[model samples]
Target: MARRSTPAKKKKTAPRGKTKTGKKPPKKPGGFKRLMLGAAMVAGAVSAIIAAASMLELDRAAHKAVNDLAKSSPAPDTSDRTDQPKQSDMDFSKGYDAPNRPGYMVERVPEGENPQNDTETIPEPRVNPAPKVAPLPSPEKGFGAGTELAWQKFATHVPDTGNAPVIAIIIDDAGIDKPRTERAAELPAPITLSFLPYATHLPEQVATARKRGHEIMLHMPMEPTSRVVDPGPHALLTSYDKVAILNEMSWMLDRFTGYVGVNNHMGSKFTADPERMAVVMQVMKARGLMFLDSRTSAKSVGYQEAQKFDVPAIERDVFLDDADDAAKISQMLDRVESVASKRGYAVAIGHPRDLTLEALNKWIPKMQAAGFVFVPATDIIRRNGVKVTG
Candidate 1:
């Protein structure tokens, strides 16, 4: 028993595919090869991400290029649009060239932008605006020396009393204030009414004035000494060229008819310029129109130029409403009587203000009773020893 030894334990052995306990042995872990496979998958994913990012950058660049190109492109051509202005509409550089069309003196501006249908806003001319065109032909060239013109054809009739101190009371600035103008027209007969060409409904207004037995004249606007005082639309500025001057004159003259002559509206500065006055006198001669120099300026050469061109002209001797007061107007009327008494005739200018009209209403009768005759302005021109020729 002492030497009893257990049989030697033999190592247990399974078949080739079995474990010692009759099961297969566990598989060994794959090391480097598996790691390599995992690494490859990760690299493929990273490449896909980078490719997507590059595609996004390219798309952004393309979009930016397209936007820039669109920005650089020009606007679409609208030349075919009917609302656009034409190239030959006007020569805005020289001045506002009135449309060759006959109507009110409308300024030619771009369509739909504050169209000046009534009047033009003229700037203060600082220099001679006359273009270097040939001078107008001599007065004897166009209408022969003896053609009967408007001044004679349309002259108001007045009995020729030899040196009887005739008084011509001219109402300037007529047709603007319709009520006052109508009242003035009703005051007396043969009150020489100088109407502004820009007045509305000129034909009708003038017809009414003429029906009331008032003589008519065109109150041609000219440049004044003060820039603040506007001379209205299409004024005859000293800066206007001969062509422009003629065009403006044409527009004014064509407004209405049956006017005996024209007188300066507010020609303080224009009447003083001899050259401009000469040009105007030539027009007067051509139109067979008389010139009544308002004589707003002391140095006016309008009378002299009229004589040079053989235009029948007269000057204003007294202003009836210079002060706009009834007493002052009465005094001025007295002065007119004095002047008429001394010089055998006088031309007094007044406006259509109520005070002037009222004063005239009372004074005309007084003067009529005092043996002073009231005549049209043209009669006074004839009284000045200048023969009225057609």
Candidate 2:
């Protein structure tokens, strides 16, 4: 005890500052409270720091996602754009131009071009057609070489033997003016076209006559009864020797290619002379040609000489177109028809006059319709079976 007295009563620590009512001040915070306060403060500060860090992380992540998306997406391309043609603005001539050129008009369409719309429908061009050609005429029976034997046998069997009446149409004086001869060629029946030896159209007339299916004959001019007659260049006469006659006949034959026989033109004196006729028949027999006596003279020995030479021979039976009148020619045709009907056939010679042609055009058809078989003169002769003389 001693001095411990009143260590100053510990001075009560001035009663640790009192409340206003003098209640002892509450004890200062304990260590645990201090610790809890400190912990709460630290937690609040940490929460604030964590919230700021999270907000910063969210912003950075959003920015990075936006950058990645921008890198992955594709960019738009605008390279080959062009304006299209409207239907009205389309030009058909863009690729092709010349239609008249050879290959341009024949070009094929391009690949992938729309056939219904892009292709054009062009009208076809017009072209002229070719003209028609006339056909050739046909031959009659008993005319050609093949029918010779048959014609001979048939001729012998004909019932009417007396005079052997037959009709022969002769187209005389025809070897000039080719077109005129061609016009005569239109005659339907087998008419004998008498060709002048030296005429300009002799060959053409002969050819056309054959083409027209007519018979051909040399129109030999001989010495006539009257002084007015001038025999043509190759006329046969009694004054000429056998050699001269042969030469003249040869010269005349050379001018034309096809001739079935010969007929006298103004040969009244020459045809009447028997020796001269015999010389002519000998030449004809050697050349395989026939003879026709025009009968200008009643004393003609032409047929008699032909018989002596054993050549195919014939005589003129009628004269057609002696008058230029159509009515008169029609009368002549009617006479021909009557004669042909009475005696199997008859012969009629005519000129190439327009009147004769007109009359023939009218009457030939009528005759044909009336059962008249108009045949070649050679056919008539062969079928008649009269042995041809010179």
Candidate 3:
């Protein structure tokens, strides 16, 4: 039993076409072959390093080219460059003299993203004190001189709104509050904005206003009634002789462009004087301008002088915000509406006050509902209180 041996077990064989699993052991190369392989690897590494260095050099050259180009070339001419890319400034496709304002543009941007429409935002107005271009030509009488050219340049394009009562709103003391002034210009309704000649950036501000479908006018500061009230520096005074008054007005008139006429700012004493107003109207007639009597005084002879000169003329029916307070301003706004309703057309003068602006923001649109169409000062000049009055 002890000697009895079991049959020897035989190893099983793999099938004919089957292969083993897992990784196979690496095969060794011969000496010369290995040397060749090593040399190939080394060459590949060297080539890669050279390619990387070349790419880096190319990047540097590209950057240097851009820098050189920037240094040698002048900066982009943003002087005429608008906020957006488009065709002409005055071309409008839609309703009632659509805005042609500086920041309002339809540009070809990238394939995506909204085009820059700065008309809805506050425009950062600027005026080049000494522009590189040559100055405008000297003033001549009656033709290319003052408001005649301005009528072409500054007057808002009006639609044929037949038989509609017009409301002309003039905002005075502009160019100070860039935001409110711009907001006033942004109104969809056509209105008028009068700028103070003393403001620093007259050209840019006035240009923006004119582009925004608003008529432009110069707010001519003059002597106020009260002795304590300071109209401003170089104010036209009743005491000034005709020559002095004309000179002062000329200085103010030459300050900017695109204004159809002048409106009194605080000229209580000066406007009341018939002689002073006659002097003012003489200059206005020579310049081909209309006059807007702010009517700071019932004694003002401005409208009378304008009539005498055959100059287009109108007077403010209501001062929108004599009081800066909102409630009072709202009442004044009611008065503006009442006056417009009663007279069929009205000219309302206001300052760039917060309360006034707030009131206007809400009330201006009411003109449409109130059965009055918004118009520029030029429109009122075209139609004195006679034709438009109910």
Please state the error at residue 95 of candidate 2 in Å: 65
The best-first sequence of candidates by lDDT reads 1, 3, 2
In the range 1-390, model 3's lDDT, one tens digit per residue, is: 478779999999977655686445676888999999999999999999999999999979856744543443233233432432221333222222234321211112223322122112322322211101111223554364233344434566677455666678898877755677777787768888988776667799887877777889988877766654555555787666554565677678998987888888777667877766777776776666668887776667887777776666777776766656788778767766665554456677887666777778778776687666888877654442212110
Model 1: how far residue 340 lies from native, Å: 1.0
Tens digit of lDDT per residue, candidate 1, span 13-91? 6567655677666676589878998999999999999999999999798567444433432332334434322112232
Against the hidden true structure, what lDDT does model 3 obtain? 0.64
Candidate 2 per-residue C-alpha lDDT over 85-159 given as tens digits, one digit per residue, 9 for 90 to 100: 111222222121212211111112234532223112222321221111111112233245433322132121222
Relative to the true structure, how large is the alpha-carbon lDDT of every model?
A: 0.69, 0.58, 0.64
Q: Global lDDT for candidate 2? A: 0.58
Runs off by more than 4 Å, candidate 1 = 1-146, 384-390
* Best-to-worst TM-score order: 1, 3, 2
Candidate 1 lowest-lDDT run of ten: 126-135
| TM-score, cand. 1 vs. native | 0.63
**List of clashing residue pairs for candidate 1:** 129-239, 130-241
